[model samples]
Target: MVGAFEQALLALMIFVIMLGMGASLTPRDFYLALKRPYGLAIGVVSQYGFMPFIGFLLITFLPLPSAVAVGVLIMSCMPGGTTSNIFTYFSKGNLALSVLMTVTSTVFGVLLIPILLLIYANALDLEIPRENIIATLVLLLVPVAIGMGLRRLNANGGAVTEFMGSLLAVFFIAFILISWVPRNWEFLLTTTPATYVASIALGVCGIAIGYAFARVLRLHPRNARTVALETGIQNGPLAIAIVAFTFSGTEAQSYMAVPALYSLFIVIVATCVTFIFRRANTAAEQKMPDGLL
Candidate 1:
């Protein structure tokens, strides 16, 4: 179980992280992206649709405890992480589309997340505090709104804040390794392999499925890559914040297992995926416009 101090620290970090995500955008950015909504729509499908289903499948097949299962499902169902934008940039994917996808999924998540969790959680006969989670998700948006306000008021400040958020997303992995791993060493040692499998496979499968989904839609390779990254790279910090804020007791630690492990592994997973994407970046693809339909 997470100590009170850890829970408080988690909340504070997430607040700053979300604030950074908000700084990366303005009302104008959304207005521009809305002009071309097709790719944006695909991202939403990938996020709320494909990713959650992926989670459901993992838990269905894996023999996870109820608390651990909850963690996996929640982690899988998250919106595109701002971390995706950083990887998308390095992967030579469409950064604009990536950012738009992140924003759109987050905005829509307020409505879709509870519904999806309710449906899937019921299937597994697990209990979720839907109201608490809903409240947590809504509260998270406050930092984002503040971040957006910062952007609208001053472009330079927004850029800096955006950088900090993305940077923190990376450093958070180290935080987990340092703070969480040591404390949970015994639990990790005794954890079932299925848990680890579920954790790793969630990202791996989401990326593969997302890439395939984009190709089937006949999207441009750059856009396809963007969709794949956006789909696989879920908002880990948000999921962690949700779990930390909504649950208490031994259940809190169990609920945190997948999200914490996923957060640590995703950086490694995305790094490898980004290398492959870089290899696939053809000259023609580079010359092609970054704008997505």
Candidate 2:
């Protein structure tokens, strides 16, 4: 199990990270999302559709233990986080679409996550605590609601909070490295090769499929890149929070292995993906976004 201090730190990271995600949006964003609905469609098809199938295939083929397999399922089903938005900005992708997709996927996740978990968990004969996960996800929304209200009330304060959330999303990675990794160095070292491969492959495969899916639809290169990162880079902090809060002792640690490892590896994965995306940016595609990213 994660140490108490680490769990507390993880909770704080999630609260503010969610708050920032909330602050990044306004009421108009939702209106536009409904009007356009493009991002929403993409988010649902790519994230809720393909990603879980990928996870199911991975766990089915790989020799992951039951707890570790469930961990992978949870990671695979997560929504795109603010981390994807940051990467979309850096990659010169469609920031507006990225944010919309992140928000859309996350909102839809509240309904989809439990259903998806039940389907996959049942198929695999895994015992997932879906009710606990459901409660945690719903509770997590409180911060988003608060952040949105803050944004509506004070623009400057909202921006500061938004920036804090993105910065802390990155900082959460550092926290895991310094705080979680050291304490669990022995566990990490002893972890099987298959577990490591599953952790790393989830993001990599998700990105590849996302980019390809976007291209198939003839999306602009920037939008395609945005979809790719958003697809691959899931909300790791949320997954960690879910696992940390939902389970305990050896069982919790076993369940945490995939999410924790994925959180650590995804930064590296997204960095490389971002660089590739940056190179793919055409001068025309660079000018495609109407100034949102």
Candidate 3:
């Protein structure tokens, strides 16, 4: 069973993360969303649409345990993580579009996540508590609203948001290194190859499909890259919190494994993808005249 302290810690971490997200936002951010609604629309659709189906298909075909399958589904249904914003910046993608999509997806995820989980859980014959999921998602909005209010009132709120973002990254990396990975070392060693494939494929397909859809819809090249990163980097911490709250004992541990592993793997893959995009962008700049670039 997860200890009471651990549970409380997870809750606090998620709250801080959401607060940081809201603090990062401004009134102008919403204005941008309104100004270019199509990019946001395409991103939201790609995020909530094909990703869940990909998770469903993976678990359906692979011989994964029920807990692991449900974990993957939860991760799939989550919103885009702020990590995507970093990746988008490095890739020379549309940073504003990336942030807008992240905010929009997260807000929409409050409703869409539970609905998607219900649909996929039913299809897979997995038993999940819809009420608990709904309650947890609702709780997430409280801190976010508080942070947004702070940003609206204070001119220096961006500094606080940046601090929170740094804290989140540090806390996650420290927790995983000092606690989670050591505790789950045996499970990591014994995990099946198919499970690894599924986790990696989830991130891969998210990027590919998101970019493909955006390009098909004739979005700008920068917007297409932003969509891809946003789709690929899911809110793994949120998924972890959901699993931690919803399950206990061996079940909780089992369910937690997929998201934890995916979190680590996705970073590596996203880094590689960012590098490729950076090289391509550099090459394009060289090809263009001084003023054209």
Candidate 4:
């Protein structure tokens, strides 16, 4: 019971930190979101539609236990990264699309993640705790909305936003580092070679499967790249919190580790992939004038 309480507290802290980072945006960000409706929709489709199906399919094929399978599925229900916008800008993809997608994904996550859990938990014969889902939504989405609202209301709030955002980012990272370092330290060190291999394999599979779906849907290259990264980057920290509080010491915890590792792997892959796509886009742009290629 103590472990569960600790885990919940840590998750809450991280969620708050993420929200704080988001609050630094200006009202222009919201207007920018409206400019690229198609890109936003494509991102949503990749997250809410393509990735979940791919996760379900992967879980079915893998030899993982039921708890892990459900864990994988639940992680898939999460949205694209808050930091994906930075990568998208660096890669020279459509910036408006990235921002809109991030906003949409974050909002939808408040609803979809819980519904996915309810469905998936039932499949795994696990009980659904509605309160946990509500708490998570409040912790994550509320701060984001508040930040956005502040930006809209105060034209000169950027400095304050940055201050809060930076502090929150530090808080979130510290919270995770302090708690997770102690709790999962032994597991991190003693994880079998097979476990590392499995983690990488699953991360790769998520990218490949999500990319395939995006390609099939005939999404634009920019959207395709975003989907691929989003698919690869499951919310591992969130999954860990769920395992700790809701199902500590159960088989679920072991399975949940896959998502945790996946989050780390996805960040690395996204950085690499963003550069690759950026280089390609730069080469193509150089061939054409007026940014048309």
Task: Give the clashing pairs for model 1.
Answer: 39-293
User: In candidate 3, which residue pairs clash?
Assistant: none
lDDT of 3 by residue, 108-216 (tens): 8888888898999999998888798888889888887888888888859755775686469536645665667787788878978777888899999999988897778
In the range 130-244, model 1's lDDT, one tens digit per residue, is: 9999999999999999999999999999999988988888887787888888998999999889989988999999999999999898788888888998999899988988888
Better of 2 and 4 by TM-score: 2
List model 4 lDDT by residue over 147-223, tens digit each. Answer: 66765677457447645554543344345456554666676676555445555665566667666776787766665
Overall lDDT per candidate, in order of appearance: 0.88, 0.90, 0.80, 0.60
Measured over all alpha carbons after superposition, the RMSD of each candidate to the real structure, in angstroms, is 1.3, 1.7, 2.9, 4.2
Highest-lDDT candidate? 2
Give TM-scores for every candidate, taking all chains together and pairing residue i with residue i: 0.97, 0.96, 0.92, 0.74
Candidate 4 lands at a TM-score of 0.74
lDDT winner between 3 and 4, please give it. 3
Model 4 global lDDT (CA atoms, 0 to 1): 0.60
Location of the lowest summed lDDT over 10 successive residues in candidate 3: 284-293
Go through the candidates in order and give the clash count of each: 1, 0, 0, 0
Off by over 4 Å in 2: 284-293
